[model samples]
Target: MNFANRIRRAGIRVPPPARLVAGLALLALTGSLLLMLPGIGTARPLRLNEAVFTAVSALSVTGLTVIAPGRDLTVFGQIVLLALIQVGGVGFMVLAVLVYRLIGRQMSLEDRMALRDSLGLLSLTEIVVLTRRVFKVVLLIELIGAILLWLHWRTLLPLSEWDAMRYALFHAVSAFCNAGFDLFTGLPQFPDGVPNDGVTLTIFAILIVIGGLGIPVVADLINWPRSRTLSLHTRLTLFIVLWLNLTGALSMFVAETLTAGTLHAAPVGQRFGLSLFQVISARTAGFAGFPNLEALSPGAHLTLIGLMFVGSAPASMGGGITTGTFLVMLISMWSYVRGFPAARAMGRTISQETVRRAGAVLTVSLVVVITATYLIAISHSDIAFLEALFEVVSAFATCGLSLGITGDLTLFGQVVIMLVMFWGRLGALTIVAALAMPRRKTLVNYPDAQILIG
Candidate 1:
């Protein structure tokens, strides 16, 4: 067989979860090398560690970085960064399927299964059609966002026409993808951050919200206006998303106002905008309305940590246990408290399997954050416990909102954070499944073992 056929055969033998891990790893490696090539850097080429970390962060669509993209990299490098974010956000499998179709090669059964797993879809039916439509929607949204951003920034920022257009497009993709990378961070004019005017923040907030909504929800919502109906999953996602943002915003505003922190002495209107923007950014967007995060009170920090841990929805550009998983867990707890036979939400019963999966994800995610935090705390003596915890949670959730400690981390600590980001991006359950060995089914049954009560 030819090289391509041989490679395909080998890939087919791997489990879907393992295939996904391998694909992202390979892409990150290639991106790392590309980022180190001549003319990519602003002054000197990136070091091995810098390149690897940047590649992983961008490919995972997590915004944490050791080096500043705007100040340290050339325009070419920024373009490369953008490319990685796009591929990572849209999913490499989707692009692979697209390429296969373009080459007129039919996807094998194995390929279809891998694609289905990547998209987190329950069924394999119409997977190809759905993939095509998803790509179209993603492109359309990004295109529109870029155009609007260009118009908004044309007169606001001091830049030539070409640079203005470039910044607009770059920020548009970064915002819509929930990647959190920003060119404005490197600009001297905006030391803390660019202006957080209501108009700019609103545009970004809308994109972030849409991007964080899972692919299935987005597709479903497209037809909802005509159908005047919604699925249980979509309803739960929407309700939780709305509730979280509102409550988060309110809590943040109260905390900051009481502590006289970031919002101190600011106009009521501006305070409201900053509060909502920060809460929305906490949901995996990572853009900073108030860039001096350390200035926020402990209460505000705690609130942000909670929101980051929750993250965004499943199969979204962002990461977390997902809104669906979080909602199911909440309902499950309520059902148990009420002595109900099954967990229910919005007048529909949730399956036991989904509840179990949510619990597993939450348990594993907690362990990951706790363990990483302990390791980081020991490695960096100067860092505070709360800050370490926050950083670990941010990495684990792929939220990318740091308390300005990313640059101060040791090499070992940085590696741990990178691993957490990778784990967070693929998800705790997916990684567990990928690492777990296959087992054969058995018809045998045994009596349940008795256990002590809590």
Candidate 2:
């Protein structure tokens, strides 16, 4: 038989999830190669490991880096990073589909299927229309944010007009992508590590919040009147997002009330602002208003660790197990304690499959974080356990916040970090789906049994 007929006879086919993993892998590889070019970095070409780490970080929109892009890379390299953030934040499938539509090419059956799978759409109907709408909404929000930032920053900083505009657009996109990369520390006229100006913080806060809300939630918001109803996904995403933000800010404020060289030294208004910014950044955007992260109290660090673990909403640029997964698990526990057979929220029952999948995602993610933490600990034995844990969680959650050891790690530790960033971006479910064999239904049905459980 020919190759196609032989494969058909053997019953082999690649699933959409697998295709996503493959596509991302190819993109990351290409990004690394491009970064290694001589024109991108300092006098010398970028090293392989450093280039790979940056590529994965950018494509994942994670914002972690070994080499400082600002001091170590030329403006051209930074622009490439921005482009990666844009494409990665919107997702590979969305960009591919857009290119196809712009060229007046019809989407193939497989393309439609992959787009549906990647975008987390409820149905395949009107996928193209939805894609365009999402793209437009994202661009509109980003453009407006960039303009607002430029207007505010132009008079505050002493940089040239073009330079100030560059910072504005760079940070606006970085914040919107929840990719914590910044030009503040590396650029001229800002000897301080990050911009502490209130307007800047406020703008970043807004962008990070909107970006972390995920595309589906944004669409629900745009079509509110016509739809006249919200999906359970949107409802839970919003409720959890608000709760996490509030709780994170309050907990950090209280925890660092007396700590020195950090929140304690700041004015009351600025203290709250810093707390708000840190919590929001920890929510998945890792920009720093307070640069000396090592100065925070252990309690404050613990609070941040919890927030980072919870992470942002599903289908957003931010990572971790996601707030949706965390809330589902919490609700499931509450229902069980109240003696309910099923978890119910807003007078609706959560399906068993959701609970099961949430459990799997959480469990797999825990294993990933713990395993990576162990590797980082052994690799960097001189660092504190909490610091190592913090770095690993930051990388695995794709939050990009660090305890200041990102550059100090050895090559092996850096590789471990890159792997965690890649893992965090693809996520537990996608990774599992990509690896697991497809199931084939059997003729016979198995009997069900009950067993004692925790």
Candidate 3:
């Protein structure tokens, strides 16, 4: 408090968005330092890049990894990583606010505004109540998931009760946070992930979907008085999620079946599960089940890219332009094709400004992904164009799924991925909005431009 007060007295005004960004950075840096501790590693010393990368990945809730975390980090380190995931996944702001409220600290107006922004709440009036609800929702779901996962592991895999429970808790948080992290890397039967196991995949997939569904949608669903009373946002989000997952899974199922070296030999049921899991994980969950990514057909590659690019819904743990924004732009374009002056959905009229903003986000995301891809491709000439594109999209979407190229990138390429991960996690526009504070106070409106283009 004194530190903040001193900074305030020094005539330096720090905006909430900027402060939020700073707080996340501080957390990452602290986690990185902790990861560097000698006890965190097993005999071998932790590399600078490894430590920093893991910290960023954990804090961003992006599961991209250059090394096997289970093999590299000790149990203590894993716990630290878990803490970062929970804080990052639930959001640092909400956790901080929760702590403050627990200690009976009065949330100031600035704090309230930050909470409102962090949670994507409509107003500040009910933010406190909403925060309390979020704490309950996160804890309850994770707890239940852990218990169920432990039971499943004991029944399916050969593991002791203690070990199973430990793995269960770790994965439960990872799955719920949409972190895509798994501790099965060095566990013998599961080298990469539990690819062939339908039971485990089902549990992970459920957690991923629930986590990818934004907090606003979750809260709305939980609090809705009736089915008919659902908000348009909730309805649109649910519809898009269902539509995207169905189409994405079906596309992968077909593509993989057609591809000779892929899931063709697997049983029909297993094939279906793998396809469904991939599509679900592709939308920012970062888990890769069955038949190695490199073995997949070219068509499947393109499909995965599209899913990663569109990502999950906004105000969610996952990144991308968000399902809502992507669909709004698509619907708006279709509306324009029919000569409608404005975009409309579910009997509600969309404002021109909203349409424009969606377009802007989509445009900026494309530019960032393309530019990063080009840079990485040129520097790492050995890497194929498609692979480069996949890495960039995964990083920019904060989706950790990869074609096994993450560890092979040059220092420059790794830095590019890191920057993209940072920007994608916080959001491209959000960084701009945070750093470039608006100062114009003009009441007079300028005439709109009449430029035309195809």
List per-candidate RMSD values in Å.
1.5, 2.7, 1.8
Q: For residues 45-100, write the lDDT of model 3, one tens digit per residue.
A: 67888888888888888898877777777888889889988988888888877788
Provide the lDDT at 171 for model 1.
85
List of clashing residue pairs for candidate 3: none
What's the TM for model 1? 0.97
lDDT of 1 by residue, 1-454 (tens): 8654797768746778888898899999999999999998998999988998888888878889899898898999999999999998889999998998899988877778888888878888988988988889899999899888889888988888888898888888888888889887767976877558778899999999999998888877976888899888888888999999999999998998999887878997788778888888888878888868898999999999999899998888888777777888999999999999999867788899989999999999889988999999999999999999988888777777889899998889889999998998899878898899898999999999999998
Task: Choose the strongest candidate by lDDT.
Answer: 1
What would the TM-scores of all predictions be? 0.97, 0.95, 0.95
Clashes (N, CA, C under 3 Å) per candidate: 0, 0, 0
lDDT, residue 323, model 2:
89
In order, the Cα lDDT scores of the candidates are: 0.87, 0.85, 0.84
Number of the candidate with higher lDDT, 1 or 3: 1
Candidate 2 yields a Cα-based lDDT of 0.85
Question: Who wins the TM-score comparison?
Answer: 1
Query: Rank by TM-score, descending?
Result: 1, 3, 2
Candidate 1 displacement at residue 45 in angstroms: 0.2
Model 3 residue 122 distance off true place after TM-score fit, in angstroms = 2.6
User: By the lDDT metric, which is better: model 2 or model 3?
Assistant: 2
